[model samples]
Target chain A: MNKPPTIVIIDYGCGNLFSIQRALTELDVPSTISRNPDEIAKADKIILPGVGAFGKGMENIRRFGLLEVLGAFVASGRPVLGICLGMQLLMRASHEFGYHEGLHWIPGQVTKLRPGQPGEETVKIPHVGWSPVNFNSNNDGLFHRLQNGTYMYFLHSYFVTTENPMCGIATTTYGNNVFCSACCKENIVGVQFHPEISGPSGLRLLQNFVFLK
Target chain B: MKNRRIIARLDIKGPNLVKGIQFDGNRALGLSEDFAYLYYQEGADEMIFYDTVASLYRRNNLIEFVTAVSKHIFVPLTVSGGIRNVEDVQKILRAGADKVAINTAAIANTSLIKISAEAFGSQCVLAGIEAKRKENGDYEAWVDYGREPTGVNVVEWAQRVVDFGAGEILLTSIDREGTGNGYDLELTARVAQSVPVPVIASGGAGRKSHVLDVIHEGRADAVAVASMFHYYYAKPLQRMYSSTNADGLRLGAQIDEGNLEFLNARYGGILERRFDPISVKGLKSFLAGSGIQCRNM
Candidate 1:
């Protein structure tokens, strides 16, 4: 029998790590949550799941000393998935409370969804609840079997804008703001939505990631 | 416009799913996780697991429950009741809850709203406001699961929590809850208009049209229902629990405790003429047919 692939969910004291681990368990796939560089290096796939502030996320990742480990993992051309703030961390920088740096794996800058103008105050800040993602027909990377315009749960004040158009795989609209909800560049994949908590369609997206070559 | 969220609010006491009239006299329904998974499959936009007696006990004990539910049910989960400090908020979030709703603590120390929002982004903080209509045709904020009345005005408090960094307001009407009359549309409209953050109109939803009225007339961004969905699944869930059904097996694996007495009695011991069962899928389709946007079934 062929050996089962090893999946590692990076744990840096942010985001819901159990849900991601349990989602894979529901799929009958075994995985582990760790910040250990050796374990992460040996894994066939790594999922970077996170929630909370951008500066805190980057700080926690560095505090765990996963910077060089992650950099080497990305450089190895293996599958690396970043979720929510994890996706934001893959960008060049974020302008949340203050300007903060990111991994720059995918060239982009994370900024507030709506910068709050006079009439724009009507547009809600956190952008909570459900919004549909319009998949890029040309490159439907992780969203392979999922239908176009699939509604996914979103809860973040800031969003990512990839410098390269090819990196943008899906777009979602909230009020007047139309931003990228899912993106990928080469071997790196990231989604702004929490697939672990997003139901069956979300499970399918995770399955796609689990089997990616 | 973004899809209007239809959240399944489960009032939990001890380890069982429960429903109450005006936040009083809670009747155990079944297992909370069973109903939560059913709602998720039915295309409910989100789920709220409010520990009904957490405040009275002076601690939020739903961390284990939150961890178990977040595993199988893939949807946004909000844990409410007895969130006293930033550490409590951190613990719940760490347990896999997407958001934490604060009511009694925030009313006592409003700075909790600001500090938690700063500690964890505003998106993770929810301001839970339980409102009761006064004789003077105004509303007052009530805490301790609607037991004690605070002098704070509901409308003004709604705006203040948003300024204090609450991302959303869960507005529950004490006068109309579990009465099946409908939402307090006037109160809902007032808070929805005052706060820029999303206002989730909760309580007193006995029918499908009541949800429509709240969104259109009440101007609420989302609507949460407990009795309507729980009562509908009570009997069927009981049957599956007895048998070795696949869903039952899945539910059994996650939850080790539940109250099956209400299920065994078959709606006989409770108040007579309770609401007829309403499926979450049926409610969403009904809302969609009425031109209201919701996640597709």
Candidate 2:
């Protein structure tokens, strides 16, 4: 059989590295977790998974000299998936813990979800829990096999607002705030929810990412 | 409205999944990982594994199970118990746990919450509050598996932890825990109302209505169930595993741990008269039927 496509899970010392790897393993796909730019350069697909503040995430990405390599990887037209904070890192800039510039892989700003108005059903921050994501008309296969309004687990305080409305592939509502939960531009895709732990729907989403050509 | 969460809380004693009434006399139901996977499959929004004995032992023994369980189930996992410092939090999160719930050390120092939040992020830190109602009708915070009192008012402590950078609160009612009586809604509402972040009401969930009541009345953003969910499967799983002699099907079925002695009197280690088992899926549908939003299967 042809060798399975090489999938690289970028390790910037910022997120849970094993959960996604284990999910891929369950899918019968072998992947590598590396921060080395050389290994990242040779991958068929690359996943940027992060779980922290945007400033700190960018600091680590630059410290490891991954900015140029990641930019080039995106430029190569290979499929790229960014999960949670990793998705926020793909935007032009983030206002989390002071303004920090991102890879600009997609033009967007990562901003905190506005607090719900008083006496109007308070909207919790960190948006913790399982919320439904409504898919747009975009035909990106990342959400293939997943229905609109399918509940996915989300645990982030900030969300991405893309400059181009078409970039938003899926949107989730937490209180009155309906922000872009998933975005795509060219070969790059980003999701605010952690699909690795999102049950069957989540597993299916990852399977869809892997099946993408 | 945002969907409220239904979390499956697995209380671990040694390597076994245990449940106790009023925070004492725990009986082992089965292996921890088995039940965690079962809950995940049943549509649990999240999972929290609390090491019941970790505080006394001064070390969390849940790393192995966290690593094993996280590999199979694709949901956010929270680990609590004996997480005294930032390093402990880092170790648990690195082992694939998405969040860490702290109680004993946070009460002792309070800075652990702020420091861990800064070191990691606010979303990574959860303040575990064990509250017991006093005679004056006020709730006080307890730690070390509800064995010691901190003389701190529960509602005040909830806000304090949030101010200290805790992203969420895991509020357990020691008075209602494992009692099948239901949650302490008054206490849950007091703390939940005071905090801006999400409050997960835990410890007592005897039936479907009790789960509904906590969300509606107590204002809890999430509800964590242990006995109501676990007991539903304990007797059936015991009979199936024992009949097939599938000891290996479980992680460590033969281990003499937890309140196995209490379970020895019964045939399958469960007291059928005490509480009825409710499936996580059943509770979700019931909640949805009652107009409360939950993640649909």
Candidate 3:
């Protein structure tokens, strides 16, 4: 029998590391929280949990010299999960608290959610609470066992718009057909919602991630 | 076009619900169980439980309280205080809280708003902004339970929090908190205009007219009152019931007498026949015995 993979949650002065750790722990998956580049580099899987402004969060990663380390880890073909702001940091850049660069692991930019058509009621930023995620990819390992139109909890203002549509494994609806959620290239999955907070369905999603190839 | 929200704030201190003025004139009111049950029966859109001691002790017991309260009510429950990370947010949500409010942590990190909002969903993340009118004629954001000044402009911070993915902004005026002079209309209007998320006005609600003023003039999506409701110092029910005359008429219809009678009988008459102010301390003690933590403000 093979041993379960070790998961490492990044702790770079972002929000809520313990909650994710607790979720992983509940699944009997061994995990550790670390801000050190060395620890992240050696992990079997890396989970990036973030909260706050995108630019500042990215700056913290750069300041701690975790960018190169993260880039190398992704290059190594191990699974990397970016949650919320962590997902946003995976984009090329964001216009939060001023134009700032992201890690650029995924090819995209983070932009605010706005009303799609003219004269449409502003769809309001920070699309909070529980909303459904429409899974677009059946073969995507990140969401392999998840069903389409599954409801997950979401809380985000900015979303990623990729030049490569194939990178988006799922999408959710807000005011119009704009991107409410997404996942990326295999081994690099970014979810706009917090599965850890989405009740039973979210817990199952995290379980799938822990056991994914 | 969003509906207005009527929120009741429960401040827990040890095993009692306390109310005070200027965030200091503290006093025990009633058991949390009775108060929460009563408010839910009265059609409160939401409930906010602030663990005033969590930060001081560096641990959150509000989750347990929320879980206990959830068993008795069907409305959304928001728990706050001492929520420092995503794990804390997740635990609170799992424990039955519909939303987690982040205050001091947000001022210290700001990014927590985005991270929590992203991980949990924006609707589950609430950014609490404590503001005070400074001598400089501008509102400033305060942290450390409204003890320290961030020196950040209230309007700018509100917009930034929205950008950071905060689903709602809970704005409390420190100056007007216990004064019941009415909401800080100018401050609230400034924030509501600057950000696109729903803004909840807090502090200084002395009458039902104040709730109306905050909703109309302040342009707030909701109003959170503590002292007025907790101490029975004002007629919250009358105000809630009277709002039916408003043009928008967002308040929920009054519960029918038949339904009230059924509830009264079902709950063994613990529920009062009318909506009146109750003791915060008494309510907290009742809930504490039932495994809920009530923090008095």
**Top lDDT hit:** 2
Residue lDDT tens for model 1, B121-206:
78779999999999999999999999999999999999999999998999999988987788999999999988888999999998
Instruction: Report DockQ per prediction, comma-separated.
Output: 0.53, 0.74, 0.08
A135 in model 2: Cα distance from truth in Å? 1.0
Task: Give a tens-digit lDDT track for model 3, residues B16-130.
Answer: 5655567774544435555676665554546898887787677897766676766545455788788998889888977767788898888888889899877765767889999
What lDDT tens digits, residue by residue, belong to model 3 across residues A19-104? 67666765677899998888888999989987667877888888888888999999999988899899888888998778998888
Q: What is the TM-score of each candidate against the true structure?
A: 0.89, 0.94, 0.56
- Model 1 clash pairs? A197-B74, A197-B75
- Compare candidates 1 and 2 on TM-score and give the better one: 2
Question: Over the stretch A109-152, how does candidate 1's per-residue lDDT look in tens digits?
Answer: 99988734677634676788788889875554587788888888
Question: Which sequence of candidate numbers ranks them by TM-score, best first?
Answer: 2, 1, 3
lDDT of 2 by residue, B65-109 (tens): 898888888888899999998889989988889899999999899
Model 2 agreement with the true structure over A1-213: per-residue lDDT tens digits? 756789999999887778899889988888999999999999999999998888989999999999999989999899999999999999999998888999888999998997778777667787888888899864658877788888898988899999999999899988889899999998998999988888899888988888788
Pull out the clashing pairs in model 2: A197-B74, A197-B75, B232-B277
CA lDDT, every model vs. true structure: 0.85, 0.86, 0.71
Lowest-lDDT window of 10 residues in candidate 1 chain B? B249-258
